[model samples]
Target: MADSVAVEDPKFTLQEVLDTFKSCLSENKEVFLEHYVAGWLGLVRFMNSLGSVFSFIAKDAVNKIQILINHLNGENGAHYVTVQSMVKYELDNQLVDLTKRGSFPESGCRTLLRLHRALRWLELFLERLRTSTEESKTSVMCSEAYNESLSQHHAWIIRKAAGTAFWALPGRATFFDVMNVGTPEQVVAMLGDALPLISEVYQVTEDLYVQNNILDLP
Candidate 1:
C-alpha cells in the first residue's frame, strides 16, 4: 500500500507536497487519512534528503506513517477513511489505550497524535525559516522551533540528541536549494502559502484529541 503513493520523482517540489495536505481536506473539512499520510511521507523524504542527522526523526515518523497505513489497509479500513472517522471508530471500539500504553500499539489515535505533534514542530520550524534573513542561522531556528513544540513531548535523551543534530543542519542556501522549489524568495513564498494549511490540519487534529480527552494518551 505504501509503495503505491511513494514519491519516486526527483522533481518533487514543496508545492506538490503542500498540495497533498490541501487534498487531505474534504469540503466538509474532514482530513482524509490517505492524503495526510502522503504529506508526511513527502516530509519524511525531505528530512531524509537533509542527511543522516535527521534519520532518527525520519525513522520514527516512518513507523508512525506505516502504522496509519496499515490501519487504512486493514479489514476495518472503511472506518478509518478520515481523521474524524478514525477517532470515532477507535474510541467507540475502545481500541485506543488512552491511559497507558498496553495493547493496540498501532491504534490510529495514538499514532496520529505523534505525527500531529511532529507537524507542529515542522510548522514552527518552517515559519521561522520563511521569515529568516540571509544571516539567520538554520540550526538556531531549528532548535528554537523544536524547543517550542516537539521538545515538550520528548524524553530528555531524545531532546538532547535532537538538539545535537540541529547543529549539523545545512546553511539556509543549501536548505532552500534542497527544497528544489527555485529561488530563496520562492521558497519563502511557498512556505507562506503552505504553513496555514499545515496549521489548520494540526489544529483540527488537536481539537479532536482534546475533545475526546485523549491529548495526553500514554
Candidate 2:
C-alpha cells in the first residue's frame, strides 16, 4: 500500500517533492493522512539528499509514518480516511487515549499533532531558505525553526541530538543545489511556489486540531 503512493522517483527534485505535498490538499479541505505521510516521505528523500546528518530526524519521522500506516491498514481502515474523519471516528468510539497513553498508545490525534507541529517547523525553515543570502547559515535557520515549533515537544536529549545534526547542515549553496531545481534563483522561485500550499495545509490542520481540542493531546 505504501509503495503505491510512495515517492519512488530516483531523480527526485525538491519542486516535485513539494508538489506531492501540495497534491495532498483536497478541494474539500480535508487532508488524507496517506497522502500527507507520503508527502513527508518525499521530504525525507530530500533530507537524505542533503546528507546523513538528518538521518536521525528522518528515522523518527519514518516511525511515525509507519504507525499511521498501520492504522490505515487495520480492520477499521475505512474510518481512517481523512484527518478529520479519523479524529471523529476514534474519538466517537473511545479509541483514543485523550489525556495520556493507554490502550491506544498511538492515537490518531496525538500522532497527527506531532506531524502537524513538524510541518510548521518545515514551513519556517523553507521560508528562511527561500529568502536567505549566500552567507546565510542553514544550521542557525534550522535550529531557530526547531526552537519555535518542535522543540517544545522534544526532550532535552533529543533536542541536543537534533541541535548537533543542525550544526552539520550544508551551506545555502549546497542546500540549493541539492534541491535539483535548476539554478539558485530557480530554486527560490520553486520555493516561492511551494510555501503557500504547505502553509495552507498546516493552517487548516491546525484549526481542525484546535476546534477538536486535541492540539495539545498527550
lDDT of 1 by residue, 26-121 (tens): 898899999999999998888788888888887888888988998899899999999999999999989999888899888999999988998898
Write candidate 2's Cα lDDT for 91-193 as tens digits: 8988878887779878877887888999999999999989999889999999999999899999999999999999889888888877889999898889899
- Mind sharing the TM-score for model 1? 0.96
In model 2, which residue pairs have backbone atoms overlapping below 3 Å? none
Clashing pairs in 1: none
Question: Which candidate gets the maximum lDDT versus the true structure?
Answer: 1
Number of clashes recorded per candidate: 0, 0
Q: Which lDDT value does model 1 have at 186?
A: 90
